[model samples]
Target chain A: MDWKRYLFIALIIIALFSVVIFVGKTQTPPLVIAMSMLATTLMVATPLTLGALSGVFCETSAVINIGIEGMMLAAAFFGWLAAIYMNTIFGYEPMPSLITGVVVAVLTGGIFGLLLAVLSITFKVDQIIGGTVVNMLAIGITGFLNRQLFFEKNSVFGGQVPHAPGTLPIIHLPVPKVVGGVCSLFTADGCPTFANALGKVFDQRPIAILAIVLVFVSHYVIFHTRWGLRTRAVGEHPRAADTVGINVTRVRYINVVIGGLLAGLGGAYFTLESVPSFEPLMTNGRGFIALAAMIFGNWTPIGSWAAALVFGAAQAMQINLQFFRDLIPPAWSFLQQSYIVGLTPYLLTMLILTGIVGKTVPPAADGQPYEK
Target chain B: MSENKRSFQDALSESPLVVPILAIFTSMVLGGIIIAWAGGNPVAAYIGLYQGAFGSLNALSETAVWATPYILAGLAVAFAFKGGLFNIGAEGQLALGAVAAAWVGYALPDLLGAELPRYLHLTLALGAGTLAGLIWGAIPGWLKAHTGGHEVINTIMMNYIALNMTSFLLNGVMKDPSPTNVIARTPLIAETARLGTLFAKYRVHWGFIMALVAAAIVWWLLERTTFGFEIRTVGANPDAAQYAGINVKRIITWTMAISGLLAGLAGAVEVTGLNYRHELGFSVGYGFDAIAIALLGKTHPLGVVLAALLFAAMRNGGTRMQFMTQIPVDIISVIQALILLFVAADAIIRYIYRLKASEDKLVLTRGWGG
Candidate 1:
């Protein structure tokens, strides 16, 4: 509705893009560099998109799922463990075994989500602490099980001989060369084969594609469906929803559980998709970053997708810091450390949360216990 | 619900410890089941755990050593809880404090080009560390006060920033430079800055004693002082506090600063009293453990002391438990989490134990938008 605001924002983003290109380009042909950056941004955005969607679902139903990190952790370990169990113990092929792993991961997340639901809803626990308990449980249980099942000699420390097993296969999509090829005609020398540009992005694995599809699906489901209305109603006013004959408890439980299922898929992305091996603390702080994205996006699925991509770009920028180093003069070598650039996403998150300009609205009933 | 008119003493007399005791018992029962499921005899493992925590003078002293940091961190969280704030940035605050104190301990002597007196040097080191934590904690507090930025998210973000910044600085500038030192740690503090061990061949130091005194001080401040009265009033109902002419915003900022100060003291004591140095890996989960301690202690000062000892015993004894029964030391973490779960949601404990609910229960952090 506000055309001026949209135009101004678009201009700013275009200006920022031009600045990045001007400062980053070198003798190495800018087109290839730019395409790879896009690919990496998509790569980093995959898990964050799923995590933010899960956050949106839970918060829309008035439950704050701070345990998303823990759920992802639990699902990550269990998913890999399931794969190991099926392939090594049961002697199954990778396809069936990987499916089983995905199922287990989803179920693990659902169970943890159920625990959070029971604690925060039925027992009326402090929601934040309840989520924290789930996180602690995930870490402790996974670590304890890791030692018993995987550690060599089952010793108190030192030996870490892990069991290797089968993994999921990646699905490469068709190249977007035809469209990219046309766009490159505008460039003076047709920098690189635009096919390489399109191919770089399409070479993504299965979960990455699913993340893109889920972003659209989640956006539509939240905005265009009857269930979305009930969720929002319950989040804003459970009493009013109840008066209107909606089952507030059932809606919250279903939404939160579904949220957990999405979180589990995000977790599996780490073990089954991102990398093959399951390491302790592998999920890292991505779950928290996803939370930040959710807040920054104002709890909307489409908005979260964009916010997550920005964060992903931030990380990608650091990983490909040679481009940034090219910006610095050769004489100022001391200022070109990658570590300093790695601070971007976190600092960006803090700045976003600080909201120097306007207030970001959160779900009204988030972290509150419903009283019948 | 009808007992609101009862005095505080009457309330205490009417089974104040029932929920916490029930929570502890329930968690232990759950933990026993877990241990049994893991193919170890729960009774033997617990017996071994008990022995390891208190079997000898060394075990008792080790438990005390663990409790030193736990008490300070727990009190920090507890103090914040009293003010209706969740100070999850304790981990960051602790690290900043440790690094600051280490810088003061080693660098100060060299910077002055003279050997400073023990009293002044130690105080200055600790004061600097506390000041660092105070400033770190105040930023989030200030943001929450002015911008309505949520402290929980800001604090967690600060944890990452603090940790990575500490890592970068440690590797670049403050890294131990001796041939044998490959790790990211600072050099040992000056002899004058190091705390004296309490006894021969024992690791416990004056820090343990200081922790107890600190607990007493927190108790007295919360219960006796007018400043604390204002804090409690603000925590209970900010609108009321504002109507009473109390500076609610200032109280919040001060509460967080003091909480950070306590956490900073924990780091400072750990450096001077036990390790005599700061490392990137030292005191990793003490801040998280402190939350459980604070909750398990019913957010009371003395209760925190006892709860810290309990947690410390479990942590200190975990190694022996693992050594004897081959159980993972993470069981302690599991049990601690269970305890927090039961404590945070006492309705489950009360239902299981068939205990009557008490009036005027403690409140944790407010919901979103509060």
Candidate 2:
């Protein structure tokens, strides 16, 4: 009900209208476009929300983690590796592989968080530098591992790497007759296609749905619980918390560990949910985007989740905007220049940070180490 | 004579070289153990790494080839440290510089409608890169001084703009339209504009010498001059520097510009001296790695040179270790990470060794919000 939130949503609706008009004028099917946008939005939003949730834990503890990208990349690789090992060694299904990926990712995140906390808090090192170091290490290690394991000239996975340009697995589900009628209209344009309809019900790919659920659970823990209160206190004011008998360092360490676990899980989304195998730098800069979402959300868990959705939708919009390729012109087509179009989220971040025009304030201790 | 000898011995113990050497030895031993644990023959891998990095003249030349840009970029980060700003956008700045250098190197002769002399064309190309970096560096400094925007965020954001724009330009406009070329890169510079190779038998060139000279100049600038004093004063306390009549904003801007200029030089050297053309992925992560180099070097210009050489050797040798022993290049990353971990959290190193706490702590960044 906040004016700012309303304004943001209104801006999104206006942008959507302009896109729809551009598509309609260009002779694209409206129903198809609408359904594709819906599907893409949900798909992109899943990982982003998970990342934002992880970022909330760190930001609330006053640690601005710029290493989320690295964490995600490393986690993605290890998750896939763990999955492959489990399938080969223990004869597990894809479900077990996904679980293994999440578990390994959490452990990886915890280790990295420990290193970051030790450097920034224990040694009183600069948090940004420490975060950057972790990021570099992640990139180097991931790049090296990717070259060694994945880049080989082999028929690995027997060539079934999901998301690498192929038919998506579709499962049928029950829907109301009216919704089915609407879906029928959509299917005419390749939208409410049999696959799309099937994707919507029993449509629960466990990882993506689990990630969404984790977001709400993480938000609840950060906002409502005693642990959450102490965590927020340590981030906001270590001295004040110390005066009150909250063990600030211990809280920071615990939260950092938990934050890492979330980041690790978020990383696994790249490998377990999107693709069957890992790619070098697959998480790319989403981790940094998540941090930006956390900040843009004003250090609150739910707000950050919403912000991640906004960023994720921006990504989805870039793809859905392709329906207007004919209207947008060949040279400046959002499809051809999707990389440029992809910059919308970062540009949005800059605008938000430049202050609502001047008052961009982070949490009081967002990047400060607990001195005591 | 005994007292004099003791004092001389004390001076030697306090020498800058001791710290870096110790750091290197410790890292190497730790790397060896990691390699063993990772199921590799540490002895053979070490030999291969050493051989590939410095076993022969060609290896020595390649080592210098990698070290040239590392030294310049390391200086970029180190110089910024003196001004108390972390120049994280060196990667972007370096990319912009390389593109500018390549454009000038290749297009200027065509623009002028004449074949320019090697010296003139090379200087112009190199200068274009430096100027490009100066502009990139100045923006964040100006923003920090006037608008209170954090440089960390801005610099990181600028990196995206620079890299993406560079990609766009290379893929679209600047992309070499020659039928044989398909990758996103510019046309090669004319032979006249390239910095001549030093040995004629190796890829090593004048850039190595230039880097060393730049290091010397940086050392003199930080340790000897009035301008350096102003930079240090502002870095230590901008408020105090303002009280002392130093124009803090101007100094921050100049410091950033100089830092950018050095980073630009790193890019320019790679193009004109090493790579001969500006490709999208040519520079890789040298700018980011420079931060680690600067930290390991203790932010001294000499320290930067030494650290850069060590980093250069590891990178140069890593390929051989992987090729010969089948160990992943990531193992080297583990070693580098451990080094950074130990250096950044010196307490861990200190606790392991039971050493007394050191007096000088490396404080590179201002508090996060600022």
Task: Evaluate every candidate with DockQ and list the scores.
Answer: 0.62, 0.47
Off by over 4 Å in 2: A9-17, A29-35, A90-92, A150-207, A330-335, B1-19, B242-247
Per-residue CA lDDT of candidate 2, range B9-107, in tens?
Answer: 566545655555556668779878766765578999999899888988989999998898889889998888898898888888899999999999888
CAPRI-style class, candidate 2: acceptable
Shift of residue A26 alpha carbon in model 1, Å = 1.9
| Angstrom error at residue A23, model 1 | 6.5
Q: List the residue pairs that clash in candidate 1.
A: none
lDDT of 1 by residue, B283-360 (tens): 677767888999989889999999999999999988898888888888898898888888888877777765556556
lDDT of model 2, residue B326: 71
List model 2 lDDT by residue over A195-235, tens digit each. 45444533545556676778778778877899888888888
- Assess candidate 1 and give its lDDT: 0.81
lDDT of 1 by residue, A150-250 (tens): 66364432345334454567566656655555757787654457766767877777778888899889888888899988899999899999999999989
